[model samples]
Each structure stands twice: as structure tokens, then as C-alpha cells.
Target: METLANLEAFMRSAEHGSFSEAARRLSLTPAAVSRNVAMLERNLGVRLFSRSTRRLTLTEAGETFRHSIGDKLEGLQAAIASVSADGGEPAGTLKVSLPPTFGLNYLMPLLPGFMERYPRIRPEWHFENRPVDLIIEGYDAAIGGGFDLSPGIVARTLAPAHLIAVASPAYMRHRVPPVDPTGLGDLDGIVMRYLRTGRIRHRTMRDAAGREVFAPLRESLVVNEPAAMLEAALLGLGVALLVVADVLSALDDGRLVRLVPRWYCDAGAISLYYPSRTLLPAKTRVFIDWVGDAFKARKLAERFAGSLS
Candidate 1:
């Protein structure tokens, strides 16, 4: 039988199309991954990949081997994980991807308690802006909104992703408050430009009564990051539409005031995304439950609602 390390290296290398990328996913060195793949090829007496300086391509035999072992490999890994979990404590690297601001402001706070509970499970977290391909990227889970519902992936919503208009008290002091979206025309707007599209995001407002209003904001200042936009608003630069989770503290402390209190923009939900599997790894299972419990205990769902903002 081939060593699990060699099989894993071969599979990951094939999936990523590069030893370096495979190494990144496996937390191994490029040379180690390459050597393992070479060993696997030698054992099977076949050329698996056609390697070039710039690119790596799979041979015909390699494609056949991958297809034959794909599901089996996954099953083996799951079985090993299950055995490890049942044998003793849950012990493995728990890799996750999270939005930078959301991770820092919300998830990071729960890390200490989690570590205290499960000391054997190591956490590797990547803070990024864009949604990650959880399986392809080798992440155990991802936390964010608006991730595509890829095959074999599932999402558990943590809170509603609602955007509410906010501005600094200093900026709002002399300005007449907007009764609705129409009045926002006079206020300088600190708006967000989608990084991918380079297009200005226009927010449509809805109230509890199911009334809709078109909010036309003057793009006096534009930014891509929510943190930057929040800072810009806090500096009294202009009014901004910010997520409720980010601005909750600011509003509570009087640093920022909500505009058009009755209206909010529905962006969807903040959720935890993970592989949809019959037998989930213990580490991932605990993490999902932990976050859900925290959200319930803190009443974050209620707090995150834009209407409440």
C-alpha cells in the first residue's frame, strides 16, 4: 500500500496543478511535496505529471488514476479523522478563512475560549476580503456573506447582513437629518466601490412597513474597504452605508449616528460555510457549534438586524 503522505501529496499536487500550491495547502515544503509525488510515481511505475518550468500538466494515465482514487481518497481521510476523533480527543489543524474586519471585530474574540476548550486542535486562519473556494483552497470553513453555493458546500447563517446609513455626530450636528432616502442628496456620501467591478454600489432602502425608497448618495468619497469607509465616516468626512455588525459599537457609543432610522439595506446574511458531508471532522463540527452558540448567547442576530440599527 502507498503511504498516506505520498497519496495525499499526489492528490493535492494534481488538484492544484503545482507542487508549490499543493505544499501551501498541506503545510509542507515544495521540495517535500515534489519528493512525495515522485515517490508515488516510482511506486506505481508511471509518469503522473508532465512538468515544465512554468506549468505542470497531468498525463493521460495521471487523469485516470486521479478519477479512480478521488472518492476513495476522500473516504479514507474521513475514516482516519473519525478514528482519531473516537480514539481520543479531536486533534488536527483547523484551517478557516474569514473577512478581515469581521474576523478581527467578532471571531477573534472567541479564539481564546475555544483554545481553552480544545487545546489539541490548532487553528490556522486567513483574513481576506474576497470569498474563498473552501474545498479547493483547503480551508475547513469560511465565514462571510455572499459566497457561491458550490457543490458539496453548505452555509449556516449567523446573522442578517444588513446595511444602515451612519455618520459621525459632528457631521450630523448642524445638518438637518434625512427623513428618508430622498433627503440624502444634500449630505456628502462616503460610498463603497466594488473592488472587482470598479463600480459604485447604490443602496436601496426598505422599511418595516415594506416601503421602498431610492437612496441617491453623492459620491464625495469612495473606498473599497468597510473599515476605511467606517473610519471616513467617523472622521466626519461624510455619511456612509455600513454593515450593522461593524457600526453597532460606534452607534452605541455615540461616535456615529444612524440616518433614516426606519430604513435599511438588506445585503443578505453573514454565514459559516463548510463542506457538506455526512461525516464531518470533529474539529470543524465543534467550531460550527461554538460560533452558533456564541451568536445565540450574545444575541448577535437581534443586534445585527438593520431594522434594529
Candidate 2:
């Protein structure tokens, strides 16, 4: 019988197009993956991959083998996971990815309760600004906005990523409050530069009447991080386009206030992305349910819809 490890190594290497990348996903050294592939080749009596310094291209035989075994491997993995989770008690390392500021502000508070409930599951999470390749990076789940709908992944909408114009009370006191989006040109703006694209993000604002306007920023300060932009606005630097969820407390406590009440930007949906809905492990399933319940309890999506009274 062929070793499961060797078959998995061959499958991952072919999927990732590189032994190093497969190693990363499998949490093994490249040498180990290479050795496993070599052993598999010897056992099969056929060359599976065309080895190159920069890439690993599959041979015809390898492609044929992959097509035959790919689905079977997934089934095997699902079976193993199901068997391991015998009592539906989530008992493994739950790896996840999240956006930095949003995770810190929103999800961090829920961690203690989740840990207390799932004492057998160890949480391993990273806060990143960019979208992570969940399968390639071996994350169980990810929470963020603007992720590509990649193949073999599913997303659940958590909230709308609504943005609005805000400024410190001290900054707005000396200036005329903009009645509409176009009037924003008169004030100094604190704006965000896209970290991935390195381009300045322009604002597209819409009013309650569905009237849309393009408000190009006159940036007095350009920041890449959303947290920094919030801090700058708090220091009375200038008017800023910020996520309502991030500054809800500030707005409620009279530290910051909305500039144009009728106009706000609809960025996208904040979602929870996972590998497969059918083969979801108990840990991820419970976490998803818990997060959804938390959002409902807090009325997060409705309250942070950019219309704060």
C-alpha cells in the first residue's frame, strides 16, 4: 500500500507548483516533501514531476494521477477529521487570519469566552492587512473584506463595511461643516493610501436619497494603516474617511462626529471565509456560529451602518 504521506506530498506539490510552497502548507521541510515525492515515484515506477530550480511542473503521468486521486484525498482528509472529532469536541489548533484593526477592536473581546468554552482547542491567529491565501497558507478560516472569491472557498457575510466622513469636534469647530460631499474640498483631508496598490483611494459618497458624488481628497496627511488615520483624526488633524465600526465609541462619546449625515461610502461586506462548508471542522463551525451570535447580540451590522444619531 502507498503511504498516505507520500501521496499527500505529491498532491500538494502538484497543486502548489512548488515543493517549498507545499512544505509551507503541510508544515514540513521542503526536503521532507521532496523525499516523500521521490519515494512515491520509486513506488509507482514513473516520474511525477519535472524538477526545476524555479518551479515544479507535473509530468503527464503526474497530471493523470492527480486527476484520479485529488477528490479521494479530500474525502480521506474529511474522514480523518470527522473521526478525530469523535464527540464533536473541537480539540486541535484552530488557525485563522484576520484584519489587524478590525480584529483587535471587534473579535479580540470575544476570545476569552470562546477559549473558556472550547478548552481543548488552541487558537492560532494572525492579524494582517492583506488577504491571505487560506488554503495555501493553511488557515482554517479568515475574516476580512475585499477577498477574491477563490475556487474551493466559501464566505459568510458578517457586516457591511460602511465608511463615513468624521473629524474631531475641535477640528470641525473652526470650519464650516460640509452639507454635502462636494463641499469637502475646502477642508484638509486625512486619507488612506492602499497598502497593496500604493494608490490614493478616492471617496464615492452617497446620500439617503441615493444621490452619489465623487469627492476627491486634498490630503494633508496620507496614511496606510486605518488605525493611524483614526488616531490622526482624533488629534484634530483633518476630516477623515473612516469605518463607522472602528470609531463608534468616539462618535458616541462626542470625541468625533459625522461631517455629512446624509452621505456615506459603502466599501464592501465584511465576511468570514473558510475552505469548505460541507467538510467544516467542529472548531470552525462553532466559531462561526459564536461570531454570528455575537454580531446579533450587539446589533453590530445595523448600528454601524454609517447613520449614527
Candidate 3:
């Protein structure tokens, strides 16, 4: 039992690269986490981590040990959860990661209902743009699009990530609207650059008739975040490519209008992502099912579908 505690501490410390971070996840003091790891090292007669003033790093032995035991921990946790099912009631912290604006605008509305239903399930969530490691970061789930499918992670698609060209009515007053996707090249484009890679991305827009053409717009203004790019478009800076879900309200209120409505870029799927656990925690399982139901009830798939006209 003491060995199990040490193993848990060691694994979390290795994942986060700090006893403090591991302690936070485990709800233990940093000193306790450090002591457990030291005890584990003494028992094994091998130093697991090389500590520095700035950070803690795993040693070669630690890496080997982690590789041998890391996956087994999940199995162990699943077994424990199965034995202590608490009469199938979902309880405990449900930690999740969500995209900033999308989570706020879309998901936040459904939370009151979820809370009312699952009174024992505490939601610990954060809004972040960057990709998160579900296992390493201790997140039960994440919701977003454009994540690389990593090992031990699975995604359930919720909606199509459809992007279309949009601009304020004021901006297009004197300017001629694009007759085709190719005509967008001549327009002043407010573009978003990839935040992590700092690379400008261009995509081919497809029309209802399946004709695809690449928009070769000159990037007059480049921004990283989508909100900023939308701001530029709203301020009549230029024609901007934006997610249909993000600007749906503006388009409806006549603040912004869709350009070349037949053409849209299929940016992939917005999905709910979780670790590929054989035996998922009841809290996580319920949340996944509940959210899926919510999306279906809201007709989010149809609403966020790629433009056909």
C-alpha cells in the first residue's frame, strides 16, 4: 500500500516534472509528494529524477521504469473505480479543457442543466487555445478542433469546423463582392497565422457544385487569434475567413455578411477528446453522454455544417 502511494507520487511527478505540480493534482502537499518519491527511490535503490534549481527531470532509469509501469497505473485505477462504483452515481472532479470563445459561447449555456442533474460531480474546467495532454495534464476531457491524434487519445466529433469569408457591410459598400472564390485574391484579406508555428495557412474553398478554388488573398493584416481577426473584419479592415459558429450572431444581426456563401473551407471536426480508457470513470462517462445529448438537442451539427450556397 505504501509502495502504491510512492508509485502514484512518482508517476505524477514524472508526468509534470515537479513535485509541486504532482501534489496539486493529487491534493497532497509538495513535501509529501517529494517524500513519497524519495521513499520509492530508496526502495528501488535508483534515483528517478535529476533535480535542478529550475526543474526536475527524469533520469534514464526513471524513463525505463515509467515505460514499464505507466500504462499499468491506468488499469489499476480502472479496477479500483469498478470496485468502488458508488452505486453507479457519478461523483468526484470532472476536469476538462475547452477552447476560449467557443466554450464560453456554446458550452457555457448547457452547464446549469448539467450541474442540476449531476449534483455530486464537480466541474473543474479551463479555457485554453493550446493543445493539452489529457493524461499528463490530468484533464478528464477536452473540446476543440485541429488536434493531432496522439496515442491513447480518442475524439468524438460534435460538429463540422466550417470556415467562410466574411466582412462588415461598411467594408463592402464600395468594393465589389467576389463573383467566385478566385476573386478573393484581389481583396484585402485579414488573415490568421498559426499561433504555435507562426505560419500563414491558406485553404481551398469548395462550393455547392464541388468546385474548389484556392483564395490567394494578399495578407494585408495578420493576426494569431480568431477573435482578433474577427475584430479586424468588424472594424471594416478587410475580408476575413472565420468559423461560421463564431460569427453566426454577427451574420444574423447584419453586423457582418457572408461573402461567396456557396464556398467554404472544411477545417475538420470540432470534437470532444478524452483518453482511451477501457474503463472510464463514471463522472467522465456521464459527462460525455450528457454533452453528446446536448449537442444533438441543439442541432449543433446542422448549424455548424459547411456552406452549400
Candidate 4:
């Protein structure tokens, strides 16, 4: 019988397309994953992966094995979860990935309350500006922006996100405010580099009369970090297109002002992305519920309320 550890390694390697990626997900060295695969191959007397310099491909035998074992592994996982559910008070490590800016500005503040509410649940948090594969990375959940949930995962909207054009008071003093999104083309505007798709995105604005305007922007200064862009905007470098939650503090302090009020771009909903809840561990479920309730009670919901619609 194949060990559960080996089965998990094989599943992760197949999902991630590389041994190194699978190793990272499991918090093991690449050599360890290779050793596990080698042991499995030795036991079965058949090769699993077609080794190459650039890519890892599944061999015919490997594909057959995966098909035969996938359902069994899933069943075992379900069984384990069912048994674990009988024990009360979620006791396990819950891993969550989140966007750095949103995590810092919004989620971090509510964590203390969540911790207090669920003392037995320990959370491991990873914050990044790039997209992370939840299953491959062994994450219980991820909080993300503007993502279309892929198959085999569950997604819950946490808040609506509105994209607005903004500039520091000092920057606005030297330049005329853009009357609409299209007018931004004539001003010095900063464009943030979106890591998931490698696209530079901006909000298109319109006047109260519905006249179209573009925000003056160039793809230069392509920053992948939201905090860095916020800092640049605070220093009065140029106009920034940002989510309302990200710049809320600056706006309240009079450091930054919305370039065009009553006219903004809809960026879609910010949501929590996770694997299927059918077999989710108790700790993971508790964290998800806490996040949902916290967002409802926080100011983020109010900010997104009128704009997200």
C-alpha cells in the first residue's frame, strides 16, 4: 500500500507542474520530494514522471496511477475530516494567503478579535501581491481582489471594491484635477502593475454630464507593491488609481484626495478564495466565518456598499 505521505506528494507534484513547487507547498526540500517519488517508482517498478530540463510531464503509467488513486485519496481525506469534526473547538493550523495591502490595511486589524474568539485555532498567514495557488501551496484560504475563482475552489465575496483616481494635495496644487477618466491621459498618472495578468489597470472616469474622460497615465513606474505605490502617491509623485480601502487613511488625513468624485471605475468584488468547504477542517471553517462576520461589521462594507453596486 502506498503511504499517505507519498500519495500527497504525488498529488501536489501533479497539481503544481514541478517538483520544486510541490516541495515548497509541502515545506519540504525538492530533494525530499524527489526521494519520495523515487521510492514510489522503485516499489512499483515503473517510472512516473518524464524528466526534462524545462518541464515535468506525467508518463502513461503515472496518468493511470493518478486516475486510480485520486478518488481513494479524496475519500480518505473526507473520512479524516468527518472523524475530526466530532472533536469540538477547531484545533489545527489554518493557512491563509492574502494581498499585502488589503491584509495590512483591512484584515490585520480584525485578527485580534478573531484570535480571541477562536483561541484553539492557530493561523499561518502569507501576504503577497501575486496570485497563489491555494491547493498547490497548501493554503486553507486566500483573500484576493478581482479574481475569477477557478474550478475546484470555493469563493465568497468579502467586500465590493471601487477603483478611484486619487492624488496628494500637493500634487493637485500643481496640476488641474482630471474632470473624467479619459482626461487622465493629459496628467501625470502612475499605473500599478497587476501581477496576476501582468496588465497595467486604471479607472475610466466620466463627468456628471456623462462626458467620457481618460486619466493621463503611462505604464512606466510599474510597481507590483501597493504599499510602495501608496507611498509614492503620498509623496505627491503623481495621481494613483487605487481601491478605497487602501487610501482611506490618507484621505482622512487630507494627504490624498479623490481626483474625480461621483465618478469611478468598478473593479468588482474582493473575496475570500478557498478550497471546497465540504471537507474543510474545523479551524479553517471557523476562520472563514470570522472573516465574513468581521467584514460585515467593519467600515470596509460601508465603503463598498454604495460604490460596488
> What TM-score quantifies how close candidate 3 is to the native fold?
0.90
lDDT for 136 (candidate 1): 85
Q: Candidate 2, residues 1-309: lDDT per residue as tens digits?
A: 898799889999998899999887777899999999999999999999999899999999999999989578877776667776775688777888988888998999999999999998888889988888887777889998888888888899988888999899999887899888899888889998997888998979987777899876688999999989999999999988988888888988999989888888998988999888456777887888989999989999898787543
| Better by lDDT, candidate 3 or 2 | 3
Best by lDDT: 1
Candidate 1 Cα deviation (angstroms), residue 123: 1.2
Clash number for every model?
A: 0, 0, 2, 13
Q: Local error of candidate 3 at 117, Å?
A: 1.8
> Which model, 2 or 4, shows the larger lDDT?
2
lDDT of 1: 0.92
Badly placed stretches (over 4 Å) of model 4 are: 1-6, 13-62, 174-178, 194-199, 206-213, 218-222, 305-309
TM-score of each: 0.96, 0.87, 0.90, 0.79
On lDDT, who's better, 1 or 4? 1
In angstroms, give how far residue 267 of model 3 lies from its true place: 1.0
Return whichever of 2 and 4 wins on TM-score: 2
* Pairs with steric clashes in candidate 3: 261-309, 262-309
Cα lDDT, all candidates: 0.92, 0.87, 0.88, 0.76
lDDT of 3 at 163: 92
lDDT, candidate 4, 170-269, per-residue tens: 8888677765566666767677776767887655654445565555576546687778888888988887778787887888899998876766665677
